[model samples]
Target chain A: MPRRVALEGSHAVSEAVRMADVDVIAAYPITPQTHIVERLAEMVANGELDAEFICVESEHSAMSAVVGAAACGARVFTCTAGQGLELMHEVLFVPSAMRLPVVAVIANRALSAPLNVWGDHSDVMAIRDCGWIQMFAENAQQAFDLTLCAYKVAERPDVLLPAMVHIDGFHVSHVVEPVLLPEEETVREFLPPSEYPFPLDPDRPVSMGCYGPPYIYTEVKKAQEVAIENSYEKVLETFKEFKDVFGREYRPVETYRVEDADMLLLMMGSYAETAMLAIDALRERGDNVGLVRLRLWRPFPAEELRNVLRGVKAVCVFERAISFGMGGPLCAEVRAALYHLPEGERPKVVSFVGGLGGRDVSVEEFEAMLRRAKERVSSDELEGFEFVGLRE
Target chain B: MRGELSWKELEVGAIVTEPGNAAEYRTGDWRSERPVRKQELCIMCGNCYIYCPEGCIVLKEGRYETDLYYCKGCGICANECPKGAIEMVEEGK
Candidate 1:
């Protein structure tokens, strides 16, 4: 029995985490990410979730607490955003390296120097090499569904990696959308209790996260890389099974009207929903356009992305974060993925970064970017990334 | 050293699966100098015993002595001795 209910993206994520029967949640609140942990805290207080809700001091302790909890073989979770994420940066590597299945959500926010709290990908892009399995959710439903899938994939014995579900701050986290909640028994069958092989216990007397001096350090790191790379199989399998049980489909790269399009708009996070509207508006106006949304961000589906973009003419990557000296981070990775394709088959990846600090890139604006991408890939020489709406 | 272990053979999570595995590392080979104790000046006050970074000093015969088997020859024992009973001699001699 599934019930359709309207839920904000933050509550949607927290609801799925509750259904997963987590053992611990160590979270410190930050803007946008606050709603999610607040909901979880409420659930724990109401006895709706039978889990330890630890109110930690800072985002660093929030992450470190989950690492310790996961090391003790507990199903753990945490949430953070923006500057809070950077605070937790150093401890972020512990879960993945220690092979702990700590599932957390990032309500994606812009990093600060001038200090702005808004929806963006800057927080996520900074931690691209942290070795966590990251997935970007386009809307509330996807956020809920992916959070559930994260637990299954991360706890897989062969995978044994931490997971991050990225939902755009304010845009998705605050917006209310309809999500289908499956029965508790259904979730129980889908995600079994985590069987973490190396639980820290006094009786076992095993040392974890031990110092890896010289020779073994390289060996250990190589093993970790291989493990995360190889997790694609389990992640895909779990997604398939989730469709069978929950009846909602999930994929590494979700496409909208991509067939025989003259150009494609590639993006991630909640913006894809708005981009879809623009694509439709353009499609109706006789411009052949499509949208490619990155659902899986880590152990990056490079080959899958290349396969999708191979026959396409060109792809305009719309991103919310900048790679500073370079262009959009996702655009850089997309180019690298398409680089191996035999010259003519590769699509010209046009990078466009905007909607930063939560500024809205309206439907009309997206249509313009597609036209710009087509013009550049069609007649004009290729240019680097463009920040679409910056004032002179 | 388990450095010979292949990537596949390394323990999951790189956890040291064995208890008391630190004792197996013969760090004494890293020594550039060794601590020597003079019997006459030694009061067995346990200054070196507490100050030795490796905790390798032991009271063998009512006098604190440095055990060379596990000591890294850090010279902390000689540096900390109030009576100047210990000297750091070069390893070759």
Candidate 2:
């Protein structure tokens, strides 16, 4: 039997790391993300978890240390958010390119300019192409579960790439919720000892991180892209195995109340649950509104998304990050995914950016957005994007 | 020579499995000019040997000779030689 305990989202993520029995944890402290690593440091200090907790000076060093540790065949864990993630931008490519299975938890936060430490998708969106398997957790429980699943997916012999689990900063990372804490024996059975095929050992003497000149650079990039693209199947397989062992189900894209509904709101992260409440209220009032929560960001579930939006008349994409000059990052991907659909079959996508800088997107706000989307769908004015809850 | 293998034929992460494979790649082809040794002017101080960027300069029978197979003709040997025994001569001259 598993223990049901109330844990802060950051602590929940640390609990998952503990369950994974990570060998090395290299992390630098950052807002919302600091708690996750802080708990792990205590675990290491208390000798409850036998792992190397490297307290690095900066996020760049944190990622660098994990890359080096993972290269040495150690199952490593790291956590960061906001500016810290941007700081690790250059080193982010090294782990994926070298095929190191380093698992990182990102407590998603907004980028600077105003220097805000609030929940948003800007940080994760910036590194979407960093060649890691990225997933979003809607709540604390999912954050805990996804962190465990990340290890199983990343360490697979076929997919030796790094993975990142994104939990919304403050919104989810600071909230306390009941989480099913599984036993070590159960997790060990589910996620066995990670076996790195190409560990840096003196006896083996295998060369890694070789410079790729022009002649081989394209080939190397192609291989890395193909590896990440093909990792979707392995991700689903691991999720299924996790469901069987842990009795909790997860999918790349999860839908709620879409049956017979005409309008669907698309979202990711913790706000999806809040949006569900809005959908419920709308449904109670006889409105045809539904919600589609995108769980997987990378290897973007195009097929699954298209299937879910098959007959829906309109989709309102609520994004927390903007692409500047363009609209939302996720809204653009959603449009591209549905671009090939026949003119008659496709739905009108209304893009809206909201909940930025930790602004609370209330139920009333979601209802109003739905009304505006429906109005635009009828008027055929659902072309450009809008910034919701903006004062101006 | 690595161009012989297609992208699919290469290793997963473009890892160089064989140690010291850089020796097989002759970077000397990139040279527009080659370094020549003025044997009489040479003091045998081994500055050229120490300064050769590619480590292509080797001691042969108590004298330094640049192995053109690996030398990139960077002129570092000529530039650093204390006695001016090394000269950057146009290739094939």
Candidate 3:
């Protein structure tokens, strides 16, 4: 039986990890991310969860330890935010190259020298090419749901890439919300125990992650690219299986009231739900605008994104992080996905950045963004990103 | 150098099933310098045999000789030799 419980997004992730029966939890504590691994630590110390909670000195060692554990065919997990994610950057590439499904949750935050510990997409965007499956959660419920999906999707034999569930720091990570925590038996039925097809064993020894010289590096990378791209289908299959068992359906690109809307606001992370708040109020006033949220960030979900935005006249890509000189990290990618649409048929993609460093972008701001975005589309100003709620 | 494998032939994560690599690959071509044992100044100390990571140094014809087939010319043997019994000469010479 599923029980409704109030939990912070961090504890939701830990609960899912606990039920997943992860073999190792190796992570150093960092703000926002701390609540997750701390709860996990308590679980292990109290023997509520039987897993090795390695006390590592730094995020680098934390990532390194999980890689080794995963390589040895253990279901491994770790969590980090902001600077901690950057600290683990180099080691982040290892699990994917070695095809180890080390599950992780990122309480996404801003990078320093301003030293903000608050939530944003900057932390996650920095690791875009790290070759890991990325998923964003809108709230505590999705944080719990996506973490479970991540483990199942990542541990699939053909798709053994590490996965990161991005839950907005402070917004989702610290805020307590009602979550439908599923029974252990249901999760067990959903995700089977993961086994690396070629487990490192003494009897039948195998050397993994060997050196790839220049001659083979390109080919090896090509093979890796093909493998990850192919995993998109497997991800969908996992989502279907999860839905069959849990009765909650998830898609790479999730849509809401898009059928008749001429304009749509596509966003990611927790703010998408806030955008929905604005969408509801606007819909009541006869505004033909909808919402499109990207649940899956990597393997890009290019096709699904296209399907959702097919006939919409314009799309306001609301992102929490900017890509500096160009525009929003997600805005650029959304444009590229829609680039192949026949010239006049493509939606005018107006980019906007807001809610940086845990700053709030209010319902009125989203409503204002829509008016400005529609104006920009009409004025043929579908170029560069406009910062919303900027102080004059 | 030409690769020994096609991309289609790569195992998952390129895991090497046959673990002992010293014998599987002839890493001789990797050497830019070769160690030539000075048979006359030999101490029979066996330091080269102990230090060679490839384990290609052994007593052959009553001399501690470096096997050319497997030596990577890492100069470990020359560096470890106390009596200057092994001289590392340029490969072309």
The candidates, ranked best first by TM-score, are: 2, 1, 3
Q: Please, what is the whole-model Cα lDDT of each candidate in the order they appear? A: 0.90, 0.91, 0.90
DockQ scores of all models, one per candidate: 0.65, 0.54, 0.54
Q: Give one digit per residue, the lDDT tens place, for model 1 in A99-121.
A: 88999899999998779899899
Instruction: Give the lDDT of residue A372 in candidate 1.
Output: 82
Q: Could you give the CAPRI-style class of model 3?
A: medium
* Top TM-score prediction, candidate number: 2
**What ranges in model 3 sit over 4 Å off?**
B22-93
lDDT of 2 at A104: 98
- Candidate 3: residue A203 lDDT (0-100): 85
**Any runs in candidate 1 off by more than 4 Å, and if so which?**
B28-52, B55-93
For model 3, residues A260-356, the per-residue Cα lDDT tens digits are 9989999998888888889999999999999999999988999889888877899999998878887898999999999999876789899999899
Candidate 2 ranges with C-alpha deviation above 4 Å? B32-69, B73-93
Instruction: Give residue A229's error in model 2 in angstroms.
Output: 0.9
